[model samples]
Target: MARSGNEQVSYRRAPNFLTANEPEKRLDIRLSYKSFRALEEQALTLYGISPVEYSATDSRVTIYTAPTALHGYSAVNLQQAISFAVYNILVQHQKQELFERIVAVGESTYSSVNDQGRRSTKTPDAGLSYYYDGGTVLTIIMEVGASEGYTHLNADILLWMNEFHCRTAILFYNKECPKFKFPGNADTYSINDRPALEHTWFGTLDTAVLEVFKRDQNTDTCKMVVQGGSLDIGLTIGDVLPPNEDAIQDIRGERVHLRINFVRNMLASGSHDTAVSRFNHFIGED
Candidate 1:
């Protein structure tokens, strides 16, 4: 029946029997190991991305953010640009062996078993993995952040060392964050007795560069370079990012470039020494 515009509306409706007791009947489904593995494989095939966490004992599957946020920065894009620049430099130097040996993986999950006999996973911001003796090893793990909360990051690095084992780990942060404290200090705790390389980026108009040299007594030398510049979306890695305010539209895009060089000497055999260096050249654009 039709009613006039001024008629009062009825506020009654039939109860929905389907949803009345649905919450009580909801099942807490847990995945099995085989099923979880199968699902993970399926996901890898479809998405080509690593699973966040795949536990076999408890058969638990957990997903986490792949490329973690960096507060006010484009962490993922910066990571990619750095990787691309490094790759290009490696290729240019004709260091095919080292080039193929070191692979850059961004936010890839790695599985491990802890001392508590629990399966765990870690996703570093970026990892430089080296392959040797039919096994893959992480050469360095890099963590970029806007803050100085190193507790979790240090714990994860230690976990990676114990589980997968690596040569070293590095931490990069904005200058505004708290300074990194060295191990054995009164205010800091050690992470497996290994000291991580900590580098800070100052976002001032003046560019800053840091160089780290690692010498293994008399056998080899490794050098790492870290350079900071102002934000410029028009320029990428290997392109000189200007430090002038006029070059940047968004301040959040401010970035740091990293490069590594390795040199090996055959002094024992009286042979010539070989050196391979990678550098990211920056050319300012108008």
Candidate 2:
């Protein structure tokens, strides 16, 4: 019996003709295990730490500092640790709360028109969103690293803020990077009836400042007000940057995974209260 080498393998088009022929456009996006795991690996490898730094509890993942690494833990690391921990907690709670998955986007899903009616898309560094059955809603976006001149950055945040009507953006900075210094921390500045950018700082570089983005379209203004710093910014930012090949090698020692079980458990455990708390937490009202 002779079998054609290529014929042996059967190739057929997608089962659904409508969806198969449809143009591939970005819609309500979701995360694949590959994408999520890659990001976690990237984060750990880029940050000059081992994944082992994260310790998983029943419903939370706690991050610990590597014993040999100097520079002490920084706010950046602390924020990352908390985020990772909560991520796992959320995962475990997904079934109960209907929070199926979490995702990260490379850009913001928004567009705008100028006074002349010219349209343009708004983008962010990296976005984190939670997925439900019907669709996906943005949960958080991490603007990986930024230098000075973040004034325009507020506009992008404004677009997201207006769309979701929620806050909670996390921005990270390299320890040696230059950033604006406000006279005080978490001060709100207003412009044209909307919030303008606020100023904040960490003790050193590699800080992650959680900002609340507020936009007032009626007044045509956007503001990003700083909230607080995390625990491990110093250690990560100071040592890890431009994450070179050597840096990745140093980070391969351990694997750090987010334990979002607790957060998810809480969400799944209840509804009215959990929903309210989540919405409030996103807006920083709670």
lDDT of 2 by residue, 158-229 (tens): 555554443444443322233222232112322232223232221224433434332322423222232232
Tell me how far candidate 1 lies from the true structure as C-alpha RMSD in angstroms.
Answer: 25.4
TM-score for each model: 0.34, 0.32
Mark the regions of model 2 whose C-alpha exceeds 4 Å error after superposition.
1-83, 91-99, 112-118, 163-167, 175-286
In the range 1-286, model 1's lDDT, one tens digit per residue, is 0011111121011012112313111111112223333543543434333444322211121121111122213234444555565455445555334445556676676666668997665566665565556776655555554333334444444555556554344444332223211112212312332222231211221211111111112212222333333222222211222123132234323333432321111111111100000000001010
TM-score of 1: 0.34
- Which residue pairs show collisions in model 1? 240-282, 240-283
Q: List where candidate 1 sits over 4 angstroms from the true fold.
A: 1-93, 114-116, 132-134, 175-286
Question: Model 2: how far is 196 from its true place, Å?
Answer: 42
For each of the candidates, the C-alpha root-mean-square deviation to the true structure, in angstroms, is: 25.4, 25.3
Ten residues in sequence with the least summed lDDT for candidate 2:
62-71
